[model samples]
Target: MTADHKIHKKDPHYQQAKRERYRARSAYKLLEIQKKFEIFKRAFYILDLGCAPGSWLQVSKKFAEDNLTKYKDQYYHRDHYVILGVDIKKVSKIENVQFLQNDFTKPEFHTHLESYFQTKIDLILSDASINKTGNNFSDHLRQINLCLKILELAEAHLKFKGSLVMKIFQGADFKKMFEKAKSVFRILKAFKPQSSKKTSNEIYLVGLQKK
Candidate 1:
């Protein structure tokens, strides 16, 4: 009925997500990533950063719960699913997701994560970005800096052979960031899901089988 609703209804992914009970259209992006990379395979603990609106957390919770059932008999990956979501903005609660609304760049965030998960993360997902100033270059640079910080967290918290997916903007230093990820991950690839807005420079960088 509202103009915003009409505009959102124009997007097939948005409509599909609504019908499927997902929190947002962005859910499709993670679904596509999972399809391509199998990043959820054998993952017991997942950390979702910049998880406001909680769609990725929804997807992660589903896959993590499934993994609990699927890997029940396995020697590992059978731990009760631990899915954590972090954001600077508050998110409505999702069942089974433990959320910490805080600035991840700060030290307290890492301390909370270490206390919560207890062990190294099996997969880390970050769709987080800096608040856009509507200036593309400036926003891109800030996002790149955030992506770099994510890599630092990966270094400290992710287990060997773990997987990661992060959203980044393409601009100056994009390749530099990509190569930097390459140094830490054995397999790294950039993916732009069909669900992403055509005009957006946002892309998902997937790091699999971390060394």
Candidate 2:
């Protein structure tokens, strides 16, 4: 392994995550986003796509429960909050979280979501990406496709004025993906958290107040 890779294996965030019993070190990324954007504010109903090992779900559940008694917002239909996680792989059970073992990029899955929530989502989180192939350009394009798929799902299920946070690889098509996201959200931002490795190309796209 390279020196940077070896250092990352011993990073403080990873150590903290293990000590806290979080599902993975990725939890810190979401915590940083929440600190910067307050995306969880008054957000009760949450959808976590590609949530395997359930790190994001763990964070979402914490925020959702906190929003339960937030005096209710006038612009949204959030009389209650539910957290649902979908991935092809199964995650160990987390209290109050429902896990679906199915591909979320399918019409059937979308249909199931409509029935399951019966209302719009307050926030959507996606840390999903294509498995890397070690070819930077190829991996970037693949991740861009996955982001497009996630954008479509967000459009269908997210509530009016809902928020979305998703990870994307920075590369040739990043600007194109960011612009596409702009068309869907009134406020769009590209944020990089300190917890991420310096060498990684990953950055998160935060879309707020979906239009």
Candidate 3:
């Protein structure tokens, strides 16, 4: 086997993801977040930004299906649950989720989103990150900028009382992004899931109840 494959095989999360049939180990990050916060609770219309390799999409589909089954008797139209994923990179198909390949930072992306789901989204997730350039500071800045863009999209597209979970690299401007999120959300918290690499500075900003 290749050296990288060997390394990945030894990683516990990678092995677990294989066993669970998830596309990537990153699925565990969302799983841990859901376990802690129940962010998917009552989320019918969902959007995933920068969703390539679709591990998060898998978790979302499972959660939405479970929610539908649990509350099957409550709603007459139980057939609809909108889960859309957007990425600059082309993602392979997932059975129940929709994938759109477009630059989410562009204005035209909104037009595409509007065409798919008429109502505001109940939850917005962004696992968006810049390709690491080996310079931590520069990488952090780029990631924070990406997070801010996701926040802007959330502010415009999220339904009132909706939730947003976005990944951001902790850096000097981390507090600035936190403050921005605070202004837009009623409740905001920074979380690092155990599945995240211990050496990585990435953290998820969970924003609840859009105001």
- Candidate 1: pairs in clash: none
Error of 1 at 56 (Å): 0.6
**Residues 1-211, candidate 1, lDDT per residue (tens digit)?**
9998898989999999989999899999999999999999998799998999999999998888888778655476475789999988999999878998888888667798899999999999999878899999899999999998999999889999999999999998899999999999999999999889998999999999899
Q: What is the lDDT of candidate 1?
A: 0.92
Q: If both were scored by TM-score, which would come out higher, candidate 1 or candidate 2?
A: 1
Model 3 residue runs over 4 Å out of place are 72-78
* Prediction-by-prediction clash tally: 0, 0, 0
Model 2 C-alpha lDDT per residue in residues 51-99, reported as the tens digit of each score? 9999999999888777776655576435567889999998999998998
Instruction: Give the backbone clash total of model 3.
Output: 0
Would you list the C-alpha lDDT of every candidate in the order shown?
0.92, 0.91, 0.91
lDDT of 2 at 207: 97
Off by over 4 Å in 2: 1-9, 72-79
**Segments of candidate 1 deviating more than 4 angstroms:** 1-3, 72-74, 77-79
Residue 61 lDDT (model 1): 88
Model 2: how far residue 69 lies from native, Å: 2.9
